[model samples]
Target: MSGQQQINFEKPFIGSIDQGTSSTRFILFDSKGDTVLSHQIPLKQYHPNPGWVEHDGLEIINSVNECISQVLNKYKETNIGEISDIKAIGITNQRETTIVWDKNTGKPYHNAIVWSDTRTSSIVNRFNTKAESLLKKEQQSQSQQQIVPKDYLRDICGLPIANYFSAVKLRWLIENVPEIDQSNALAGTIDSWLVWNLTNKKTHITDVTNASRTMLMNLATLEWDSKLCDFFDVPNSLLPKICSSAEIYGHVESGPLAGVPIASVLGDQQSAMVGQMCFDKGQAKNTYGTGCFLLYNTGDDIVHSKHGLLTTVCYKLGKDSPVHYALEGSIAVAGAGVKWLIENLGFANNSKEIEALANSVQDTGGMYIVPAFSGLFAPHWRDDARGVMVGLTHHTNKAHIARAMLESTCFQTYEVLKSMEKDSNDKLVELRVDGGMTMNDLLLQIQADILGLPVVRPHNLETTCFGAAYAAGLTVGVWSSAMQFHIGKRFTPNPNIDHMKRINDWHKAVSKSVDWVDK
Candidate 1:
């Protein structure tokens, strides 16, 4: 757990690339789902304008290659034969972070529009206006008709018109960047970019899980919808071919990992769900990363969320297997808000220190930080929302602010969990959690206290990588099923404390955060 462990050449191994918003990591996992070797590089984010975030697409690919090379090189010194032991490589990446590149030269046309970027809010507003106009026109034409209120692409895509999706980002690039034209353009999420690069451009493909997040893929058909594509103005040719989550897409043709089959690709949140072994309906997991994502598995049935949750494909194990569906509540900011407090405000030097600083105070001292930085996601798809700190007083200090920061994630998560229950119609018995934020015991305790449910942490915090590895391992027969991981720790809700008042106050703070920006 502390450092790179020596790998055995005799045993089969799986490599995973976890390309996230904050960092790019390559981890080598043995057949038992234990990390044998790992390397991580922090990614630099560029904020050239307000509410706009971009990442150098080339730099992201370079970080991925560097991580792969470093991890493989370390294994080479310990066991040269182990390089051949790598049976397959899997990928899990930040979903909906849009990237467009030249198909021939292998160069990105512009910086990657990150999932958290709000530059396309104007574009989203345009779409919302168009939808409203169409609905109004229909209502005027038939006053006596029982007009079923048509949800704008919700039935087909399970997403509303929002800046968080890849469609709006792609549209923005096509309209704004002159170089990104139909002649030489190709658009994809971070998963597609990584796979296309890793396979030496032989495979321009994404799995069902990654595709489902695009707001372009049809949830029922599991393919790109032409009508949706035409509506979004993204050419169907620019999109990657959708594939099953567990299949050999291509082989790595360069570097130390040449010829290793690329067998799996999953969105990070869906991968975490798989890594947590939430394969059955009603099972759920919350990933605490740069942002918080809570996914509840609904098996094969696609339940259109009556609540604000998005319905998405969980994973498809095989080409012919029934595709699993899930209801997801994506919180726009969790750890990123924590990072903002640490680096921007100097609340703490390191993220782990926030716990002690926050614990210094008995509570937030009636303070609440609603981190609607890029607007609220999930149940409330309000793009106009912005970050708000309410209930501040003369007695409020940094410790209270720190506690409020951590509690923001808990409160956001609680709202999402409630929405999930409303959609699934089943109470989530316990919450299985993994990711970097799970390392903080105080955060997990807060999660349990807020939700009034037991919080479960896996033996490995890097379950995002493990989930991709599990998919690849399943393809190459490393493991038959995802039954290897065990519970490392559990935090049950405290019955002694009633948190309704605190939660109710947090809701008031969130209300103030919404609609801060008007179109």
Candidate 2:
């Protein structure tokens, strides 16, 4: 199945660990990016306070270990291959989820702060005020000719001091968790945490793609910016040394596949971009997971956004290769909104059933659901926004709400696409899509109708995992390039519906959701 002319091997394979917000999984993939074997485990999330979300850091490590063991055990029983045949391992994780641990003990100080958590909104506000005051002081102390424009760290980091990024999360931990303030403790995102444990603490490193998500890293230098670290009050020593996305970071010191080289690492969304084979400029993909993330490849240029989108590294194959940048549009809630309907509102017995339920209704019946559950992300970075449903009448049933929920995801993605187009000035010919939600053809149709653009889904919906595997395989020469990724399905735009009215009604509902909670 490999495109390269290398000698074919029956036993050699690549392994990947996809640690996502909702679950942990270990997938064994062949050279063609097809999953040969896999084991998945659902992760438990704790919400101890309103707008707060966390995951047990140890639990994350344990889950990864368990899945790897289970997959290898099954491999052994089937006599397909030995653990030694797994040439390399790759890792992709939810970005910006902060974890602080004792450097010596390897014990986390507190639960890993999830990217969706809004506990640091107040801290972000305070930091913004401090930055403004400092800027004003500089302006007053200097003449107009001597005044230097302050880009507010955006030009360097390509991010804002928002709760979604890792810097604010790390700052919050230092203030709230005393153990974290100790000199022995170090802060890192999930990739660094997993890499540390996987290599038996022999290495503390993170890929540029993951590091870019933290506000501490400079986009151009691809290293922790001292100015940013000082502004955030986080020591540079606390961060992992940044590495390329596809180089061997370290060898696995202990596991079923002990001694296997951990060759590649990427942030989950960046992995999806690679898996989608979006290597050229203007190519884009939207992952419909717990949240919807749309990334447009801008080649090597780091195009700063006039809109609320973020500029981030897409991937860097090696230290010598040029860094590919992307414009990212994040929607806080997508599949999670469907899960909320299923578990919280009893709209369906399973997430898959939502498709049939939504299809039961001809339309939403004028209902508009604004899934601002974790506040709006991307173009509208409103921390105070809350979920709202407008045009709900007595005639509205669960089916209508279900339809509206699916439509909410589509509308949000449409808005982000518009923003991306505005910032990049390049219209998307088609959107390559992946993730669990893409399984629902009805939802994809809704997405295509709303955006008036063709939607393409890869044969392997688990591109996030495959992307990691591909990176690892590339490092070990499993395949020459990611050009092997081919389209599985395509949904063309059927823009017959009056989408303008629906979008207007959605905006009206969203307006009510803004500033819902008082400070």
Best by lDDT: 2
Q: What is the C-alpha lDDT of each candidate?
A: 0.88, 0.89
Candidate 2 residue lDDT tens string, 95-155? 9999999989989999999999999988988888877777777667873233222237788
lDDT of 1: 0.88
lDDT of 1 by residue, 348-378 (tens): 8998898899888889889999988888888
Report the Cα lDDT for candidate 2.
0.89
Leading candidate by TM-score: 1
**Candidate 2, backbone clash total:** 0
